[model samples]
Target: MTPFFASAASFVDPLDEVSAQMHDVTSKPLRDIVVAGERLVAVGDNGLIIYSDDHGQTWLQAAVPVSTDLNAVFFSDPLKGWAVGHGAAILHSTDGGKSWVRQLDGRTLEALFVDYFEHRSGLDTERAQSYLSALLSMTRPGPGQFFMGVWFDKAGTNGYAVGPFGLILGTQDGGKTWQPGNTSIDNDDLLHLTGVRQIEGALYITGERGRVWHLDQSSKRFVMGEVGYDGTLFGITGRDSTLLAYGLRGHVFRSIDAGRSWASVSNDFAAGITAGTAVDGSGLVLVSQAAQVAISRDEGTTFELLDVPRPTLYTGVVSMTGGQLAMVGLNGVTTLQIQ
Candidate 1:
């Protein structure tokens, strides 16, 4: 019999290279940031994952198993977390952000998706065929697609990951297995699903063409929840009944009914709002790619401009203890003592 180590080294994907251990990781270009209890966790290009226990004062690199460009990171709780990235990679961590093991990658995800849909019934012919074609095409020599966002419940037993072309996957057994939920979604045009988050008591999925898909409790399917905008929504944020849909060109819409309906609560900034975090359900802070900050104290009903001090192509932000925030993007991590 072949040795265990020898068998494992039989094949490898180029993008599956492990992340490098580097000094001063804060100088790296990070893509997403999240607050994990008292520590702050961040992920970025080339499968980089780092954590800071002293609230972004200094950083420690984690042992990441892939070199893919991680686009988003989410923590269900302080100790359980997950990160998604290019190549359809999904990574899980049980000890906060200290380390990660590859849970799903393109190779495994391709087979899982194809098999799930092939056996699924009652799905439209076109959607099923579309998914199969994409899967086949992406199964080529490289990481063909990305899973942009990931989220899990507090119990860490349920979660979903979303990406372009209406792609969404859910796992009930804590990501031990995932099912393709894209076909069940009412996205006829195959709109790219950019973000997914549970606002209040409802699960909301955002995507291109100003579309919002809400999980129907009875039907267990995603149905359209229109917000009446024509641009792409990058993400959704809120706590309680209040929700905010962030889109291109600094456009933000507010929903007080768990995303059932929205009203124009635009922030008159010209740059794209990339990331935001709620301040204990009472307020929100948004960051733009053009180094701008918008703060709202009245549950996203109105907003006021704040300062970012340094210009960075901001992509993610999280609320920390006290009146402070941690942001990550092209310029790595920056902590602001928001007042």
Candidate 2:
């Protein structure tokens, strides 16, 4: 049964109250969207969660417990799913996205980080100061908690959630418990982490100032890799050995040798590429903040433009049934078929 859930807004601290009912909720601000088997789920501002089982022809709101802005969402399958956003909120849904329960929130996450880092600092005095510094600034108890990206494995056993200030959390037992990454990340500057994704079996994090970090399997530590740009990279997507990292001011870089070396791929028209995905294995679709769409037929080698019916700031996108796409942005959900 679909509970009479609120629209996107109606709360005290956003975490203090459940969403309330509102009309035309699908037109509210949305940030991210993903495809879960036949259903398409989209989340955005004011804790909005809407899903469509019929290729986005219609929408239905989920019973969400909090009203905080949801930043990213992922589903390991059609049933088990997760969404992370502001206030250190991580939500899980057992039966698709019909209903959700809070897994982690600001109330409990602060102390968990303190305990983990304090213990870690005691074991390694050389990095103790670093850990302590991070403990105070990164894990401070308060209402401001933002997790920008999240992803889980196919079996829904292991997952990672990333956020601002170099914060990363991992869960092994299906999100029963989550822990701070064990090893110190190479981001000494503690740049804000924008996204967490897997590329060719390697876990990578994209962040500020064109910084990209990949976990070293042997050391289990994240280390920096250059993608030949110095602007904030919003995200990355690729197929096989070809990778594309895009960001501010219409800049995009491609790494053909598995990130060993990168060359310029940016063009004059592209501007602030925000969300991207690989479709049909070979085709790539990328959308920018300028409401522009670029399609790459041959991996990330080159791109061509596509027209949008109405231009708006596009934040996230996912391929839809047939040759269409379901995208979420400032004005809400917009579905367009590839032409």
Candidate 3:
């Protein structure tokens, strides 16, 4: 005979959650969403690049020049952009995301160290000397993290990429050259960085475990910010002067005072939230792992579920411009719009 267990979980409708039950998308991981030149581009796992031309009416797969999983992409214009990912996979595109050119790859660093080690071994010094030489040569740098997010500072030149192991890489010459930024965090498994927004002349990075960090240009240091939730923070968006963050266990934190401190907001769902976006300039929408889409009109105080076509396990949500959305995962890509 099979064993049975009882639970206290309740079903909330997506539509009736606000009044009453509940419900909840992408191609790859579809980690980041951005709008450029009337086009909406979403980048994700396995070098997946997709875009919508006519205000997200439909989406088509865009060709990527690299093979590595593109964790992040940013376009200042429809004509020019850059995408970065693991294993030194940094690509540049002049024709949007249709095609890309390999710029800087991390594999080159490995090859560089290989050559350095082979040459140094001929010296035949003491064991201490050999060990020290190998250590120095292996210190590969420049976007060293498993890059998760990329952003431009309201210009085509200055840019930043943050990812695993608290790595921060900045470029001034349009990513032709990159330099390291001050990352003091000691954690090594900092997986995803969702958004790097400019608030009050400072850049803030939001990511896993409610990890938020701020960059001070004047002092040239990265100061960690307070993210009250211990759960993973996968997305962050700025509306007006408020910075909203969402993550595991329906985690929602808002900072009305420019990300200095955060306050927890009540939410209906108890499962992890995957993505959140501002809808119609008045309401916020969230896609959670419970295979449901929840909408909150009053700044996440409550939620309403939507009837979606598939479960969250089957798709990932990528929010687009004009409140349109796209989901990609197991069965390719699907588009969603509020009629």
Candidate 4:
């Protein structure tokens, strides 16, 4: 039996060692950040998983159950949570990220290929060869190939995942069983998906290219919703009565009337706003890809850079209990005690 808790040093690495440790660019920036009670979890390339019990002040690496790159994590409770990434890998932690078990190996794609070859669906040799080659290529290796965005439903029993090649998977029975869904969007990468919040009795998923899809609450069928812009929509966050969707190169869209209409806020950042998070009734914190952290208290109007000793890429920020701020990102995780 292995242990759940490990030292922070195991996950923390220097700039150069990061690439080799993760078998790729370690400094690619930790993308997904979520808080489960006092526990903070962040996932990134090559199965990197880190958790902090005392806010984001100190982080310890968890025994990753898989070697695939994980992109996003969502927790409905402190103990029950799910993480998703490349190769369709999905991990669940019943003990609040202290320990994680690979629920979905993300290798199912590979197994599907093996079965396809073994059964030999009776196709021409050339066509079969082409199919096999494409499958292999899809599973080859790298970021963006396998899985991307992962979200848990409000009930947390089910969640959706998306990635390259229009991949979409849904899980029921609390990550025990996942069902594949048809993402009518063709030839485009669905970077991220946001779950629905009750606003006028509708739920919507906002993804790449400002693509917004609505799920019928009663039927649970995804119907194409209105799309505002065509760009690499990166992150989506909802607060109060409005929804905020952002994308690459600073494209920000805001909607107060659900997904019906939107207004452009700003697509500009102070050079490296790789990821951001909006705190309810507070402000937004944008973390630069270059390890710079900035805070905008004026409702995404302006930003003030924070001073930190060890230059670290601030991936995302969230408000914690006792008015503290938690920041997570590449190679470094730190928390500011709100004075």
| Model 1 / residue 32 / CA error / Å | 1.1
Candidate 3 lDDT over 213-247, as tens digits, reads: 77756675556676876667766755556667777
Of candidates 4 and 1, the better by lDDT: 1
User: Tens digit of lDDT per residue, candidate 4, span 1-339?
Assistant: 444455544564221122123322323456577888778888876667777776666666776766566767878777788887665677888888867777665445555454554454366667656655654565342232466666675577877766654456666788786654432223223334433223234555555556766676666676655446776555555555556665555666667766677777753354434456665445666666666665556655455766655567565666777656666676645666533
User: Model 1: runs farther than 4 Å from truth?
Assistant: 1-14, 120-142
| 1 against 2, candidate with superior lDDT | 1
The Cα error of candidate 4 at residue 123, in Å, is: 23
What is the TM-score ranking, best to worst? 2, 1, 3, 4
Candidate 4 residue runs with Cα over 4 Å from true position: 1-29, 110-144, 183-204, 267-274, 290-311, 337-339
Q: Which candidate wins on TM-score?
A: 2
* Candidate 3, run of 10 with poorest lDDT: 15-24
Give the TM-score of each candidate: 0.89, 0.91, 0.72, 0.71
Q: Candidate 2: lDDT of 32? A: 93
Task: Kindly indicate the candidate among 1 and 3 with the higher lDDT.
Answer: 1
Which RMSD values do the candidates have, in order? 5.1, 5.1, 12.4, 8.4
Q: After superposition, how far is residue 275 of candidate 3 from its true place, in Å?
A: 2.7
Off by over 4 Å in 3: 1-31, 109-145, 183-195, 199-202, 314-322, 329-331
Residue 11 CA displacement from its true place in model 2, Å: 7.5
lDDT (C-alpha) at residue 191 in model 2: 77
